[model samples]
Target: MTKITYVTTHGERIDTEAENGATVMETAIMNAVPGIVAECGGACTCATCHVYIDDAWRETVGGPSSMEEDMLDFAFDVKDSSRLSCQIKVRDALDGLVVHVPSRQG
Candidate 1:
């Protein structure tokens, strides 16, 4: 399992373990982590699962794909670090991934 940290807009920091092969959005939904609405489930159709990848892990996490970039246009407060959690798969390399939830969903 990989360890992932999610910082809510309210400043609540939640650390959870995610099974390898699962998407970050899946982990958040499974753990009932607040701030990750995941309205479209794991489909890349909605922007409710928006998150900001921590700067330290940006290189490791990588940027959004062209499709994801298009979807992010509907996300609130999009930033250079913005990403859809559904697009991020859990793996050993991302053991210490950190993501920040925006104050509100788009």
Candidate 2:
């Protein structure tokens, strides 16, 4: 399993483990991590699962796809690190992946 850490807007940390091939959003939902609404259920259709990729993991996580970028335009407080959790797939390489949940979803 890949370990994932979610830092909530209120500064709470939620740790979880997920099997390979699950999306970050799925991990969040499964573990009841707050702030990742996943309104479209990992379809990448909305920005409800918006999160900030930790600066240290930015290179590893990479940039969002053009389609995801289009949707991110609707996200709140978007930054160079902003990403929709649903677009991030879990894998061994991201074992200690950390992401920050925004104060609110778009």
Candidate 3:
């Protein structure tokens, strides 16, 4: 299992141990991590799963693809580092990852 720490804009911290095959959004929603609605359930269609991937981990987890990029444009408060958490799959390489939840999700 890999531990992924989720930090909210309000400073709430949620740490979850996730399986390698699960996506970040799956672990987050299942563990009740706030700010990610995941309305499309990892289909990469909804931006409700928007999150800011911590800068230190950006190289390992880069930006979204064209499709996910298009969808992100619709999310609220999209930033240079914004990403749809549902699209970030958990892997052994991503263990001990940390991401931040935005103040809003639309």
TM-score of each: 0.97, 0.98, 0.96
Q: By TM-score, who's the top model here?
A: 2
Clashing pairs in 2: none
Q: Model 3 misses residue 77 by how many Å?
A: 0.9
Between prediction 2 and prediction 3, which has the larger TM-score? 2
Alpha-carbon local distance difference test for all models: 0.94, 0.95, 0.91
Residue 55 displacement (Å), model 3: 0.6
Model 1 C-alpha lDDT per residue in residues 30-104, reported as the tens digit of each score: 988888899998799999999999999999999999999999999999999999999999999999999999999
Report residue 44 deviation for candidate 3 (angstroms): 1.2
Q: Is candidate 1 or candidate 2 better by TM-score?
A: 2
> CA lDDT of 58 in candidate 1?
97
In model 3, state the lDDT of residue 65: 90
1 or 3, greater by TM-score: 1
Tens-place lDDT per residue, model 2, 49-76, is 9999999999999999999999999999
Ranking by lDDT: 2, 1, 3
Task: Give candidate 1 regions above 4 Å deviation.
Answer: none
Q: Which is better, 2 or 3, measured by lDDT?
A: 2
- The Cα RMSD in angstroms, rounded to one decimal, for candidate 2 relative to the true structure is 0.5
After the best TM-score superposition of candidate 1, give how far the Cα of residue 22 lies from its true spot, in angstroms.
Answer: 0.2
Error of 1 at 35 (Å): 1.2
Q: How many backbone clashes does candidate 3 have?
A: 0
